[model samples]
Target: MNATDRTLAGLLSAALSDDPSRPLVTYYDDATGERVELSVTTFDNWVAKTANLLQDELSAEPGDRLALLLPAHWQTAVWVLACASVGVVTDLTGDPSAADLVVSGPDTLDAARSCPGERVALSLRPLGGRFPQPPEGFTDYAVEVPGQGDRFVPYAPVDPDAPALALPDGSELTGAQAVERARQDAAARGLEPGSRLLSALPYDGWEGLSAGLLAPLAAGGSVVLAPRLERLDAASLEQRVENERVTHTAA
Candidate 1:
């Protein structure tokens, strides 16, 4: 009965078909004081468009590792889902050597450039409308989202056992393993489609990549991302829990 029982592409196709009007994500920007909510239909379309860009613009393929250096913003969400749809390896890291393509904010560009790979750095500034000077050898993310249609050009089916992400501990897990872990957790907790989860952490690495991005999608739930915390304070976390109405919290 799980909605995400099919492949990531199938899960998205289901979401687009059945509950296109449902609110898939809600973005709350503390800096700009803006709130943007997207429905399932729009969310699916954007993911498809981003998938095309990753394959066409960035030269990403099913087995290639497309790194994501994004924060807990909307664009991060889009690329995470897009990578899943096409069976590309999405290795989330701040370290540029770990990725084939990197998407990030301005501050990390220096660190990103040092490692040297096929990088695709992006700006978070334009998302807020106060466009900062972009890093050299990067692309404009603002100009990238528009001008693409909603159709997801299907690719060859992927092996469920294929590696989808690389871990920091030099460990690699297959896509089936990832889905099984999520399924086990969800069944233990009685979770299903429409269940809400609060990502209580950053999405830049192994723990974040597994629990924050993949698990929620595998469980057919919306993942609510928390702001990057330089320091994790008890009181601040409690407030976030109350604000986000987090059904399940993972580190």
Candidate 2:
């Protein structure tokens, strides 16, 4: 990211323009036996579709609160960026009762049911498929997102100073603030343009969020996010680092 880049969305735009074919997010879930890699163009497409679903279908606004009851997987990264694109405040704690919208995974269905506003559920299956049976009082994200335009045009201008992320600690930061913080953290972590970081952190707080997604983007780097890193043996992880050309590791 450059001096002019202020928000997470701007970082993505820069990445897409810089190298659309570069790998942006590579994910692995040992428990589910899932592995997926998304190039800059593909990641942007998913973000566009997800943003459309948030804006058009869920009526999400720039200042809306979105609780994500998801893990540190590829789809979660997509949702975070989508929220950033729409200027929505992403709450990782996923407290449904306090959010304007909640997107839940299979394990958190019951918790998400408590959310009073718009609720969407994902199967978190291969290719980010929809639930086999729709949850009550909730829309299926996979079913609705495909029809959204590949390109996203926000209906309103999102102020960079508006709050973009809310952590469970009751702390919040604007888009610009988050970007600045991520840049600092990225530098501290020795990430630079085109650097590939292999991260094994949950997406539950600022540290994890920064390492797994925001910081790398702010640094114009990519990530190989291991959601179940502890399950992978040392040899396996070493092989992964070699295969993915990981330049750094965050445990």
Candidate 3:
């Protein structure tokens, strides 16, 4: 891969071509007893569909800003990459009024509805479920995303220099910057090809973004994201490390 091919989508495409069958994300939520695994091929497929959903159903243009109100789960990671795929700026916050679109999780339904523009809600349930009865005005993501086409070609090409991530403290990184930083962090974290990293970091800021999402992808490794980490007892956590063959960790 070229050093300058630093766009998030470009990096993901490279991963897909390099080793599509490799596992990419393994999610565990001991609190909810959720275990979800995704291979590179599977992840790419979901990203394509979600990108298509964003572009076709939500009209998420390249410059669109999306405030993501979700946890560190498998599908949330999908949304992050999906936003990057189509050049949507992802804000890791619950403040929807500041964004063009707000992706609210199960806990933020009421606050998310205050957004003036479009709204999408994810149940964050296992297998990505829709609300039992559906929300009043928001589109249920799990219900609608799967029906979208499996391919996505953005209406306009994404600029590598365009902003892609928004942190809680108002810091932001462009697509190229985020990718480059991830590469550097991956090296620093001793990640290598096929390394399995067990991480108990929340997807809140740079550290979380690096460990939980980007570093693994950047280094041709995979992440075992353990959300609600405190819920896992010492023995359970240790057992997970051995089970996943974890080579690196960030807790």
**Residue-by-residue lDDT tens digits, candidate 3, 1-251:** 45337788887888898999989999987877888899999988999999999998898998889999887878888989899989999998747987899998889988898788899998888878778978888999989987898778988888889999988988899999999999999999889899998888888787887899898999999999996778877898788889999999899
Best by lDDT: 2
Choose 2 or 3, whichever is better by lDDT: 2
Error of 3 at 247 (Å): 0.8
Consecutive 10-residue window with the lowest summed lDDT within model 1: 125-134
TM-score of each: 0.79, 0.96, 0.96
Q: Could you report the Cα RMSD, in angstroms, for every candidate shown? A: 3.7, 1.6, 1.4
Clashing pairs in 1: none
Cα lDDT of model 2 by residue, 46-145, tens digit: 9999999999988999999999999888889999989989889999875899899999988998999888899999888987877888887789888898
Please identify which of the two predictions, 1 or 3, would achieve the higher lDDT against the true structure: 3
* Full ranking by lDDT: 2, 3, 1
Model 3 earns a TM-score of 0.96
